[model samples]
Target: MLIATWNVNSVKQRLEHVLRFLDEARPDVLCLQELKATDEAVPALEIEAKGYNLAVHGQKAFNGVAILSRFPLSDIRRGLPGDPEDIQSRYIEALVSAPSGRVARVASIYLPNGNPTGTDKYSYKLRWMERLAGHAAGLLRLEEPLVLAGDYNVIPDARDVSNPEAWVEDALFRPETRSAFRRLLGLGLTEAVRACDDKPGLYTFWDYQAGAWQKNKGIRIDHLLLSPQAADRLTGTEIHRHTRSWDKPSDHVPVSVTLDI
Candidate 1:
């Protein structure tokens, strides 16, 4: 089974790209982030017409997420636990089965961008991370094939970004941010990409400004963190950088993992 994640930026603006990706990758499950549209405006009909089961948590012109499965999805979760006040539609999880009837859990996460580190936004980012860590810890107890994948909004290491100095003070690359991400991994979740290939420059996101794409200047902020059981079935991983070059492209591209379920 192939599971993939992509931050489409906005489902409305990138509907074509989303449909194109579905046709191109043909993943068994595709987790999407940054929908930036309300539930009623998600273009669900167009997507469902492509032959996939859709589960979405949406917000108006802001953070939103969804999960699309070629197979059925059950036990759908709409929000991240541990925060009653966090109304952002940034997370959605569901239980899905592979062709072999092998069940697994998957989540689409769009963590806060927390830009300019000295404000409530940054604080909220930190708190959210802690909450995510706590929730992830609890999920780990399930001992099932679980994949927590999305645009994490974190640069895990110096090797993840193009210029270490340029991003040092940015929230995504800040020490606290990276540390929080490590806490998640410390819970025994294996980062699929690094586990398969540790090479630098294998980035998933690129800034549209400053000719970032033209210069191949990018960062690897999107990720697929797999639980122990899921990690064990990981057969391969791919960074679909070509998607970033499509007309009217998003800053991010899809990253996928093939599992032996």
Candidate 2:
């Protein structure tokens, strides 16, 4: 089955691009981040018309996540556990049965950007990572086919970014942030892209400013962390870099992995 993750920036603004992608990629399951709309505002009707089930956790004008699957989605969960007061619509998970008759658990997450480090936002970002780590540890115990995919808003390493020095002060590439990401991987999760492709300079996001895309100045922030079961079936991975050049495209592009399961 083909599973993909994309941070659409704003689902409403990029609805056309999204529709086009859904047609072109034809993934069995697609995890979306940054919907920037409420549940009522999401274009569920149009999506359903494409023969997919929709599950969304949305917020107004900000963070949101969703999952679109060709198969029926069950046990839908709307928020990340461990933080009762944390209301950001950054996570949503569901169970999807692939054509191969394998049931996999998947989640779409839009991690906080936490810009201009050394502030409350940065602290919150760290705390959120901790909570995610704890949750991931528990999920690992399930020993099922699990895919944690989305816009992680993290630069895992200098090799993942266009210029390490340029992002040193940014929250996304901070040392602490990278460490947190490493901790997540330490929980027995396999980063699908890295596992399938080790080549450097492969990126998933580019800024709109400073001719980032044109200059190929980008970073690999979007990711798919697969459980051991899913990792064993990993067949291929792709970064839809061409999408960045499309009309009114989002700064981020789709990252996908094909699994035998």
For each candidate, the alpha-carbon lDDT, in order, equals 0.94, 0.94
In candidate 2, list every pair of residues with a backbone clash: none
**Residue-pair clashes per candidate:** 0, 0
Model 1, residue 1: displacement in angstroms?
A: 0.8
lDDT, candidate 1, 1-261, per-residue tens: 899999999999999999999998899999999999998899999999999999999999999999999999999999999989889998999999777889989999999999879999999899999989999998899999999999999999999999999998999999999999998999999999999998888899999999999999999999999999999999999999999999989999999999888
State every prediction's TM-score relative to the real structure. Answer: 0.99, 0.99
Model 1 ranges off by over 4 Å? none
Best by lDDT: 1
Lowest-lDDT window of 10 residues in candidate 2?
Answer: 97-106
Which residues of candidate 2, in runs, are more than 4 Å off? none
* CA RMSD, predictions in order: 0.7, 0.8
lDDT of 1: 0.94
